[model samples]
Target chain A: MITQRAANIAFNILVIVAAVFFALEAETFQTSGLLASTGLPSKFFPQLMLAFIGLCSVIVIGAYVFRGFAGTDKGASVFEDGGAARRGLLVLAVAVACYLVWSLWSFIPMLILIGPACALAMGVRSPWMYVSLLVMSGIVYLVFTQLLNVQLT
Target chain B: MFAGFDVVAQSIGQLAEPITLALLVGGIVLGLIIGVLPGLGPPIAIALALPFTFHLEPIAAIILLLGIYSAAIYGGSISAIAVGIPGTGAAIATVQDGNKMFKAGKGGEALGLSLTGSIIGGLFSVICLAFIAPILATVAIKFGPREFLAISVFGLVVVVRVAGESLSKGLLVGALGIFLTTWGLDELNGTERYTFGSYHLYEGIPLVPFLVGVFAVSEVLIGAERALQKLDFDQTSLTVKLPGWGKLMKMKDVLFRSSALGTVIGIIPGEGAAVAAFFAYSEAKRRSKTPEKFGTGHDEGIVAPETANNATVGGALVPTLTLGVPGSPAAAVLLGAFLIHGLAPGPKLFAERPDMMYAIFIGLFIINILMMVIGLMAIRFAAKLIQVPTTFIVPTVLLLSFVGIFSVSHSFFNVGVLLGAGILGYVVRKLGYSIAPLSIGFVLGPILENSLRQSLVIADGSVGEFFNTPIGLGIYAALALTIFGGPLAGWVKNKMFQRAEDA
Candidate 1:
């Protein structure tokens, strides 16, 4: 029963916290000689942007809290059902996994992961889909490496 | 400008070659196939073709891509007319009347009107582009960093306002996009903002991979959610009958007005063919003597949106060619193509390479003309394209995105950036936030940052100086009007109704 409003409020708060942390971290950017003499240091823009983002986040959270005052009720569930939630999370996990594979192994591993992972996330239970995906991955590999001569690590 | 005519003539002469003609035909056919299928449009079509363009000369490449761009917009209407489903977002408005006409057994008439409207609109806009672009390019040559900054801000804000129902959500996504671009090394200074000690981030995120990721990959993920559904439609009645000369002549006012409207809207940053189509549709309905017949399978319904949408192609190129500011997302991809060709699209481009400008102008005209012949042949088989399953499309799109992104930079890091961006785009889209503002913001980010920093230096710490330039102030004023005028007018109307109720 958690509505979009509640989710948005939580999201905004998290963003605000992140912005504050970044703003604080930006202080280590070092203000020296000419940079310090420029009236604002290198860190100025980042800090300013963070502050603005934080302010917007606060406003968004306030609006969510005072929803009725804005003449609209909090509407729609954040997730339709458990199935949707699971599928959405699975897709996110697959994306993250692909990123990790690319980072740790190589581009070939990540390329191999993309199709099967996507097909699985979409609930394609057929064995043929996997075969088709493998064929697709191979074609992509040939096209990039052979034809275009891309250095795919 | 008169001396430039010789270059135009030479470009025109080259376009007459058979190989160039073949590429145009091939590109249009390919574009139509991609566009008629659900979830693919001009940007995807162009992105897919980008790698292939690397092998061709500038004229051939531009001609082929331009063919794809024009035909794709036209192709979208095929599915909208044949089935209730829209092939592209631009064709969504076309469905209301186009599908209804098909249901009422006037499928041929509906399609004919759409085709004719699209061709007329395309032709009109190309002529407009030919006449207006060079003049605008001449003037744009005077633009400085301050002017460029104003233009970028105007584009980004307009995109955000038009992108979604929630202004705050749009702004947040837009800011997030710009913030992501701020990663890697700063250009003016050697300071690394958010590279996190990686040499891969030194050149910033590669444009091709990021766009392909955000648009193509994100779409594939979202397609997964609706993959289980089967689409059914009556395809037996699908036919196209080009409208007679008399009918088209009778509807000249609607055609001209819609073309102008589409072109003007296209000139504005971020507003694309789809928005122009819908706006033209509504305007046509508003001006019609029988407004009741509008959503009930009227020929005017097909004409208005079709004409406006196709006309926007030429309109979109104006800003992209002149100022390096892409007028639409597809144009953003096209800008990347320009960069890949080692051609920077800006004021200096006109001075440095007049032949390229002439080639684009002549090539675009040829594309529009060729679109008619190719579109007719292609539309016959276009409806069959929709039968392509989501399963096939998803993997193919993913593969294309993978190859396309890699082809641009030949770097795994770029591919990683693409995947990361794709996930972000998919998540945000599922949460009902639009990717338009985000994409536009990313494209405009460096321009905005560089311009702002330079302006600050020029202004010497005075906020008022930002508003001092006459052209800059005028642009800001127009932007303010566009943003606030709608709400202000609505408020006035509401107040008037209240007073009337009291009376």
Candidate 2:
């Protein structure tokens, strides 16, 4: 269980790192022609936002580090328990897998597999749920293809 | 204003078409079903319906979505009354007294009050929208870039302030959302900022996919974590018994006050139905003769939040239609629908599309009336929908999101964007950050960037001239009050308490 204090500190550190990377990346942004003489450079808004985010991240890190809690929750964990963390992460993984299958192969195969994959991720033992989900997916597929004429690849 | 009656008549005639009528009813039923399901709200309902609306006529699509919007807010109270669980964030306040009344065997009366209050509030706000939107649009037509900048700043700041307990988290996410929008080529100079050599990157992150991902897919993932939870509730109490004229008259003051409060709040750029509901609930309690009865099956308790939440539908549309600012998260998605139809909502929409405008206003009035009739008939059926397991919903919602987003542009890049956004939303939400600021900031990003840049060029780097416009100054004043009012009130209350102690 990752306590919110620990999570906040870790997340803020990640934000700061990403912000720094993005800010540095902003420096690489180049423009030319008439656009180059515009009121502000292309990098101005992004860099300003990155700096603001980095500053906020630092403040969050300091608050969590010194006071041992963010102002909102005293010491709640990011996830409720190990079970919740497992289920959430697994479902997320399933979603990515579904997306990957669609990207790699085709939409139909992904559609056929996504329901069972998500159900499996959630630890569902019911056979009926899997059947219902497949039926629901088929309904969705037909509605979009037949009714809306969406060319689902 | 009366000169537009012919256009209104023509819009009303257009809605009388069989297809339009059917879609309106269908949208209502779908909205109610989605609203009865916990973790699904008006925004998700609208998001999921967006793809289907692509094939619809503009008026028909807008009407269908309007039906869904008004009814979904009303539908949430069904679950709130039938069970302790609120079907939507807007219905959270209804859970306290609504469920208590349900448990006490006065469920019929509770459902009835909620239904009545919702209709009354929804209709009142629609009337207010009809009158106020055109006037506001007329005023907004003259707003320059500096005024727009001021408005955008006010919106972003207000959303961050009201979003959560931690101001920094809200600002961080809001800034991040705006930052994400800066990825595409700059609109002004056509400079590629972060395209990374991909054609899909030129347009930046797509709005519909990102929004659906943030609201729907993120919720689907979160719902999966609690998939094993089951619900079993008494179906006998789902029947709605609407209040008599006398009973309605008795609660007229509450209805009127909540509707007005909700409309006012909804007109504020980023404040939403949930905030309005909670505020109305607290106000009802504060003003009640028997405040102690509020959480204990009080009828006024159910009425206040239900009315306020439904009222926000029309109120929120004020800013959305007139200013293109999106008055709520749901309105944000509705804005996506407008963009999908190649119509930009703002002062120009009213001028260019008066028929469409009239269609929306008239269609909303009809939707509210139909919602009452449909809500009463369908409450029992919707209550049964509450027991549907999360296991079924999780996979189905995920699948729908996949198919719907894929159908939008047939691009896997968009699907990837949707998935990425969902992950981001889930992570932030789990960590107790409100998604409102992030979503609103995303909507406001283009306007903020364009206006700020334009204002800077116009002012020639003079900081004092930035506040030159009267509208800009007025907006800034309102922003300041919104930011400082709560703390100032708290300080004054504390001082008074201390003085009393001394006395």
Candidate 3:
């Protein structure tokens, strides 16, 4: 249960740091020919955006640090409860894992694992629900492979 | 205006094909199902359907997605009425009175009014879209880089203003979206900016994967968080009962007003269906003879939001088809559909593909009519649809997104991008930031950067020259009004109130 004040302070601080990195990286951009001497350089737009983002991040950080809240909600938590946080993060991990499996092995193994992984992440107890999800995933696999002619490798 | 009658006729005739007809009906059914599911909405529906359209004809693909777009908004109200839970953000306004009406045992009547109002509103917006898009396209053909820059800024700023409570947060995400677009090769100089030695980064981020991640995958994670939340709705009361013409005639004013408001709001970039629904609902309540009756099982309350939300489908498409700037997130996904067919949206599309253009306009009309028929049959099963446990929805959608993106390009880089974007969207959304600005900004980023750079080149060092064009000036003036008008008027009213107190 992360409060809005704490979350904003941390998020804004991270944003400011990232903005600085991107701004510095923009300095290394190289352009050649007549375009180099044109109206603006390639780094100009990205740097401008980085500056704007950094400024906004500062404003957000200031409001949270000084005012103790971002806006209307006085002390709202980012997640409703620890259960929600656990579920959200676990499902996200499952998604990433599925992607990795697809990248390393093939689409079939990833497809088979994705449904059960998410169900486990969510703490589902029903075996029937698990079977239905697997069937649904199988149907999706069949449709893409046979009907749409997509090579799933 | 009817100069393209032959093309329009041919396009309409093409809809007679069995495959195209089946796809159209299937899209509506899918849209309805998605819309009835509380967490999924039109953009995700469109994004999930986008990859499937890769092998189909452009006309067929566009029609199928259009069917989904139109019906999804209308489908949102079924849940709002039956279960007091808005299936989509657009149905938020309907929950108060709609659920009240359901609780009062007039569930059939409430469902009927919403269905009828949605159809009328949808048809009205389609008519407006068909008429207005070509005229706007004709005018937009003359726009230069500066003019586009003005419109893009206006779009981003307006989205920021409406998206969230914190202006800084919205602006931060908006700027971040634009910043992310600067990756890969610079479009102007072809200089590698942040490709990081990967050939995959050369195209920047792929639009379909990124959009699908932002909409569908983000929703999946969010839905996973609320997976334990269960729905208990009355299936017995789910039947729709169409109101007699006399009853509809009595509420004709509400129907027309909400439809018009939804359309105008839809035409404004990034305003979206939810905003339009809320605006129309408040306006209807404001103008009602019995304002006290609102939120107490009032028919007007149900009618206003349903109509307005459905109407926004057509309204949002106006800018999307004609100017290439999507009016809503759903339209942003729709733009992906356009690009997949190797067709660029904007004024050129209308001129180059008049048949496809007419096909979209005609297809949307057919979808709306078909929605009424399908909606009548589907409303009875909507309670069951709404009861779909999010535990099941989370994995299926994630898999769809993964396989869908992979099948599109056979690139694992895209699947990686999708996963990364989903995580980014999830974290930002959890931190109480609206993804609308992030998404709209991303969609507008290329246009914004290209236009600004091109405009700067055209003006050289003359900053004043950016405002020289009439269209650009007009757009800037509009932007000024949008930003300053509210605060300025509030200040004036406050001064008058103080003066009154002194007197």
**Error in Å for residue B222 of model 2:** 0.4
| Chain B TM-score of candidate number 1 | 0.96
Query: Judged by DockQ, which candidate is best?
Result: 3
Better of 1 and 2 by TM-score: 2
Can you write out model 1's per-residue Cα lDDT over B324-390, one digit (the tens) per residue? 8989888888888888788888867878877777777777777777777766666767787787668
| DockQ of each two-chain model | 0.31, 0.80, 0.83
Q: Higher-lDDT candidate among 1 and 3? A: 3
Residues B227-287 of candidate 3 have per-residue lDDT tens digits of 9999887777877899999999999999999999999999999889999999999999999
TM-score of 3: 0.98
> What shift in Å separates residue B236 of candidate 1 from its native position after superposition?
1.5
TM-score of chain B of each: 0.96, 0.98, 0.98
* Residue pair clashes in candidate 1: none
Tell me the spans in candidate 3 whose CA falls farther than 4 Å from its real position.
B497-503
Winner on DockQ between 1 and 2 is 2
RMSDs, each prediction? 2.9, 1.3, 1.3
Q: Lowest summed-lDDT stretch of 10 residues in model 3 chain B?
A: B1-10
